[model samples]
Target: MTDRLTIRRPDDWHLHLRDGEMLKAVLPETTRHFARAIIMPNLVPPVVTAADAADYRDRIMWAKPKNSDFKPLMTLYLTEDTEVRDVRAAAEIGLIHALKLYPAGATTNSQSGVRDFKKVTRVLETMAQIGLPLCVHGEVTNPEVDIFDREAAFIERVLDPIRREIPELRVVMEHITTKDGVDYVAGGGDTIAGTITVHHLVINRNHILAGGIRPHYYCLPVAKREEHRIALRAAATSGDPTFFLGTDSAPHTDAAKLQPCGCAGCFTAPNGLSILAQVFEEDGALDRLEGFVSEYGPRFYRLPLNDGTVTLEKGPPVEYPAQIETGDGPVTVFDPGMPLYWRVVD
Candidate 1:
């Protein structure tokens, strides 16, 4: 065992493994990497109800590595018609782990997301009563709001009201990429938390245009400036339980990504945990890494700390895969073909 670093197993707070072959191809990356993950429900039709969430959980369980203890914490994507009774029943049965709030048209397959927050206020209030966390996509859909300012603006306009209305509700701002996000979560002080993506940690919008239009670098709540990236690093490595790891690992095929107009998302799971370790190491925050990766997330979600640990070592630089064989075709890996010193010990 390496003495350089040691800690409890880490859990991913935000993850997306699309259905069927995509799920199978990508699940191992996550299962092999994190001990458990809160799976996103923004699929084709979206997991809208308790029954749907239960079925999705069954499918996810079926897809898991045989005998693997990987826990897929399921979530329900909130929509306008989402019934408070359904939400309460799911919580009572423990089928849905959290409620995902995606503003309509905010991100991939999010067209089915909530059209109006007020319309769902009853559901939100019910969730608060039932002790369910609200995982928000945290961006506005207004045609006028600058793409980069949406998250902050949403915090002010949307998240704040919801938080105020249900002061006891646990709100997780998913895949946060702006200083506004960090500050907002910080101001909420404790109850409000956020997930920081590895891509956002390492790249900015300039990186999107770096060398070319790097569509794979593109994702919702798009990357901000170097200053924001720096701020994110500070927030992430601050050893604050409010900041946790959420790859938001939305994968798209090479065809979708390399098109004249490409899809927004990054396939980072293959290298997700590796990239996170690298980021912490570079920031001279390795000692604080374990708390951020392992302790904090479980604390926020009130999940038990995992029993076993996964290891990352200082050894020969590892090269990440450029693509993974998928039933449709090869899906490009985010941070493809990159060299890194951090490799998960298998």
Candidate 2:
């Protein structure tokens, strides 16, 4: 059996480093493992302008740990009223790496998301012209639709129409959780790709509802059925360039996560790398781990690979912290519900 492995430091194609105290606390958890991350734009006010992205990036830089060579790639939240000129300028100056599309009321702090797709036609056109990628939340907010079916429905009702209209647009189906999502991306052209999260690959809806209501296991586009989880694992470990790692390592304080109508996100940054190593190993795709986590994302985004490398060693089970304390509060860490024998060796 393989006891040790080393690969290029990976990049998170989708991540949520909440602003302020939460940002300061969780930033290190990711920077410690990932070389760079595509920072989410769904803050309370949302990053809507070039200036907003610039300011957010500056704050992230300020909060970064000393001597850490981490880079936070910024993104703008797309709104119905977004202007084309602003997006073009943001891309031209490299102030933002992509535009995040969150259908209004789709998820946490996403009230400012786009409600009318037609209103953003001009902005989408500009993005395609400028070679900017669209990182989508991938779930429709229609209350009538069953929560488990939203992702598959969104592809039929929203994503497909948009892609057909703007065939050249680069779209990332973020945190996709259904076989339908997998099939869509697999059948689509090169302009489309899918980001599979560690939590989704590890847990299914059963992990959230079976035995008890495990809120920590809950998240938007909530984990699907076991068969779907298997499909996600297959796609992620398939070595297909179209699928890659995007932990979607969203963080929420324990209080926020346990309260009435708790927030939707999983705090996985602390153990993300270790958890992924286990998943790939279980899938018998250990040899392709590098392509899934490190190679595919950069190639999809047209960015250069990282210079640094990180090694994972097979050793005794790692005792990960149950929760990480931040100035804001205590944030619960993701529990993979199994012993992780492979750990990143410092």
Candidate 2, superposed: residue stretches over 4 Å from native: none
Model 2 Cα lDDT, one tens digit per residue, 1-346:
9989999999999999999999999999999999999999999888999999999999999999999999999999999988889999989987889999999999999999988899999999889998999999999999999999999989999999999999999999999999999999999989999999999999999999999899999999899999999999999999999999999999999999998899999999999989999999988999999999999999999999998899999999999999999998999999999999999986
lDDT per prediction?
0.85, 0.94
- With candidate 1 superimposed using the best TM-score fit, by how many Å does residue 109's alpha carbon deviate from the native? 0.6
TM-score of each: 0.96, 0.99
Q: List the RMSD of every prediction in angstroms.
A: 1.7, 0.7
lDDT of 1: 0.85
**Best candidate according to TM-score:** 2
Worst lDDT 10-window in candidate 1 = 1-10
